[model samples]
Target: MNALYNCISKYYPITSEAWKALSNALTQIKIPRNSFLVKEGTVCNNLYFLERGCLRGYYSLDGKEITYWFGFEDNFVTSFYSFISRKPAVENIQALEDSTLWSISYEALHLLFDAHHDLERLVRIINEQYYIRLEERFMAMQFKTAKERYEQLIENSPHILHRISLGQTASYLGISQETLSRIRSQV
Candidate 1:
C-alpha cells in the first residue's frame, strides 16, 4: 500500500483525505504463478498496481505465442485497451510469479475521479505515460534489429533476463531461442 501511495505521489499530490479514499477503494489480491490476470476474450474491468512479483502480456498467433510486454514490481499491469473500451481483451496478462497486487475497479476509479481532482489529473498523466511507452515499444519493434531490441530490453528491465524463461525472452524480442542464444554469446 505504501508502494502504491509512493507511486501515485511521484506523479500527483494527494490530500490525506483523498489518500484515505484511495486506500479504502483499492483491494489487495494474491495471484499464484501461471494465473491469468486478464484472459483473452474477457473484458478487463480492473487496473492492477503490482506490489510484488512479475507478469507478462502475450497473445497467440496461429498457435504461436508472442510476448508483448513484461512487468515487475512497481509496475501497473492491465489490458489497457480492453479496460478502457470495455471490449474483450486480445492478449492475456499472466502472473509469472506468485504476486500481490492492489486492484481498483474501473467503476471505482471513475468515482474517485469525481471526488478527487488530483486523482483525475493523476490518471490523465498516467495515460500519457502509458502512451509514450507504447510508442517507444512500437518504434523498437518496427525499426530496431532483434539484437538491438534485446539490448534495449536489458537496459529497460535487466531483471527480466534472469526472471523469465529463454523462450519467453526470445518471443519478446521477436527472435528464435537459438538466435537469442547466439546473440547472448556475442554479448
Candidate 2:
C-alpha cells in the first residue's frame, strides 16, 4: 500500500527485497462502521495502519464509552499493552466509518525488527511518539479546563467534529453531551 511504503520510506530507502518482505507481512482489511479491531479483554494481535476512514480507542466506565484518542488516515492504531505483552486489552478500537487498513501481526513485526535494525529504530521512534501523545493528553486532561480542552481538541483536530457524533466528542473531551452543547453554543 502507498501508506505503508510512505512510512517505510520516511525511515529508509528499502531494498526491493525488504519492500517485498514488508509487503508480505501486511494484509489489507476492510472494517464496517462500528466494527471493532481490538475488543476489551482480548489480546491485540496486530498493529493497524489506517488507510482510510476513522477509528477511536475507548473504554467503558459506568456504562459509558470514554474515548481517549482518534485515528484517521496515515495514523497507526493499536492497543500497545495487549499487543506488546500478549495480554488482554483494557480498551476497544472501533471503526467509526467504513475503514480500510493495513495490519501486521505482532509476531510478524518482531520478525521484521529482528531482521532489520533500521526497522527496529523506526519502531522505537514510533513508540516514543505514541508515548508522548499519551503524556500530552494526560496533562491536558489534568491541567486544562473543559472549555480549554474543547478548544484544543478542535485546534488539534479540526475535522473531528465533522467526522464523529457530538456525544462521542463530548466523551473524548471528558464532558457530558449537554456540557459539550453549551460549549459549542459559545463557539
TM-score of each: 0.97, 0.95
Ten contiguous residues with the weakest lDDT in model 2: 8-17
Candidate 2 lDDT, 31-78, residue by residue in tens: 999999999999999998899999999998889889989999988889
Q: Count the backbone clashes (under 3 Å) in each candidate.
A: 0, 0
Candidate 1: clashing residue pairs, number:
0
Every candidate's CA RMSD = 0.9, 1.4
**lDDT (Cα atoms) of all candidates against the true structure:** 0.92, 0.90
lDDT of 1 by residue, 1-187 (tens): 9999899888878899889998999999999999999999999999999999999999989998899899898878789999999999999999999999999999999999999998888888988998899999899999999889988888878888899999999998889999999999987
Tell me model 2's lDDT, rounded to 2 decimals.
0.90
- Using TM-score as the measure, which candidate wins? 1
Return the lDDT, model 2, position 126: 81
**Could you tell me the lDDT of residue 74 within candidate 2?**
84
